[model samples]
Target: MINSITQNALRALLYEVTTEPKPGLVDPGSPGPHSDMNIYTFIDSSLSLTQYFNDAVKIGQTFTGSDLTQMFFALRRKGLAAEKAMLAATHGVNTHKGAIFALGVFTCAESYCHTRHTELFTTIQAMCHGLVEHDLGHICSPQTAGEKEYAEYGYGGARAEAEQGYPIIEEIALPFLKDSTGTIQARLLDTLMKIATRAVDSNLIKRAGNIQVIDWLHEEAAAYLALGGYATDAGKQKLKQLNQECLEHNYSLGGCADLLIVTIFVGLERGYL
Candidate 1:
């Protein structure tokens, strides 16, 4: 079970980076807006986190404590180590930092649910309860990008998403991906845009240096989906244009990308991918 769960987590990371034409993201054909890293960097980073995924599952499978939050803290410590490994692999490039958190929580939650015969999302919610308050509620001086975003815009970023059990993945991306048709690339691209429509995307905001860009991002993604989303020529053109614009503005929808990774993990676990 641990091997399978870790494999799915690795697959999810690889799948998200390989999905093409993703606006402002690193892909095989192009590095998109990022000037620091490329597809190889992401691959190296993904490969480096295998042990972290294994540890997450082991923690979940063996946790017998009543306080699931403690389990979450244990996983977070491993996640910090995973982030260091990812940085080492990428030579200081911050590829997969967000993924290290979101995917770690889901991988841990999935294993816990499998062992206890409980629901996955609710287990995640229980594990992540009070995450936002504990991490963001007492912020006096902003340090990380997430803390800064919370300080300035009240956006909770990944921590808030986990606390809510990843509503975007549960209610949107997974459902959209399950029902999506066409090539795997097309399905994932469409699902990514759908996620972009709803995700706050702190990375995008940070790159644009304004929270208003999220509205523009949402509008563009919604318009792309309205054009039939990667299956139609018009939708493809729109995505290309969106990709160009993101490159021009140097905006990266990394938050949405992390959501897509977690969605893919769950989809794979549920046998939909």
Candidate 2:
């Protein structure tokens, strides 16, 4: 089970990076807005986290405690090590930090769910209960980008998403991906844009230096979907235009990308992929 989950996790990581023409993200054809990392960097970073995923599954499998939050803490400790491994592999490029957090939580929750015969989302919510308050309730000084976003905008980012059991993935991305029709790349690209419509992408905000950019992003993504979303010529042109706009503004949909990764992991685990 651990090996299978780890393989899915790695596949999710690689799949997200390799999906073509993702606006403001690294792909095989372009690095989008990112000047530092590329597809090869993401591949190396993804490969380096194999052991971390293994440990996360093992933690979930062996945890016998009733308090699932305890299991979450154990996974977080492992996640720190995973982040270090990611940096070491990328030579300091932060390619998968958000993914490591979101996917680690899903990986751990999936393992626990399987062992206990519980539902996956419920297990994730139990593991991440009060996560935002616990992690960000007392903030005298902001360190990470998430902390800073919380202090400034009250946006909880990934923690809030997990604490709510990833409503975007549960309610939106998973269903859309399951019903989506296209080649694998087309399905993923459409799903990615669908996620972008709702995602309050902190990376986009950070790059644009304002939260207002989210509205524009939402509109652009919705318009792309309206034009048929990676299937129609108009939709493809919109994506190309969006990609160019993101590059020009140095924006990145990293939070949306992370959500896509988690969604893909869940989809694969549940046989929707």
Candidate 3:
């Protein structure tokens, strides 16, 4: 079985690769089509090694998110950061434009993966791995059969949905603990609280729209923490404390996705997920 640990590791990998656009997947039917072709070629033409991580941190800095939306928000931040980094790295070749594409694809991958759709995830991951070797001369492992199948179908589904003007969050996003009356996953939620608190404290979320979503998630997390008391008083207190602290700091959404990841893993560990 694909346990939560493996799922999380896969999520982390998926998150990293998707932050960059998939090479060779651009719609020929779309716009001016790679007009300049230098950095564009490096991104739209093929994946690059600039997306890889070292010691679990992207290049050097760590990504923060404790919920799925928070995760997307963080990727959004990463995309912006990538643009700046690439600008600095390539002596201002406008490499950051490519970084925006990467972030778009990352959001795309996350939307698909959460919906149990693996197609985009597979293709993106494969391209990213290829980039690792081609651009960086570092060979990573080949993608598995499951990933391949996801790639084959995920694209078509995504395209069709886009044509219909549907939000991917409703159709493909990850499930949250508060989305249902289902049991609470204490350990995971707890970790998520910590991550969320850190993000808010760090001033990661500045946009009003993003802040609204994070605020909602904060309420959801509070509810989850309260529910977790069914398992143990200690769990309840820990969660309560986390929630209180988050409230004190003005609840940032940047870390929500990571918190969600932790919650899911904890639930799975406790047999709640």
User: What are the per-residue Cα lDDT tens digits for candidate 1 across 149-247?
Assistant: 999999898899999988888898999999999999999999999999999999999998999999999999999999999999999999999999998
* Preferred candidate (lDDT higher): 1 or 3: 1
Task: Name model 1 segments beyond 4 Å from true.
Answer: none
| Alpha-carbon local distance difference test for all models | 0.93, 0.94, 0.35
Runs off by more than 4 Å, candidate 2: none
TM, every model: 0.98, 0.98, 0.25
How many clashes show up per model? 0, 0, 22
- Candidate 3, residues 1-273, lDDT tens digits: the string is 432333443343233223211111111221112233243333432232234211112311232332333333444455565565556554555423432433344443444454544454342343233222232233143253222223432222222222222222222222333343423333334444433432221122332223344454456545645555325676566555544543455432322343233334323433444
C-alpha positional error of residue 20 in candidate 3 after TM-score superposition, expressed in Å: 33
How does model 2 score by TM-score?
0.98
Q: After superposing candidate 3 on the true structure, give the runs of residues whose Cα lies further than 4 Å from its correct spot.
A: 1-182, 185-230, 258-273
* Model 2, span 154-243: residue lDDT tens: 999999999999999999999999999979899999999999999999999889998999999999999999999888999999999999
User: Where is the poorest 10-residue window by lDDT in model 2?
Assistant: 1-10
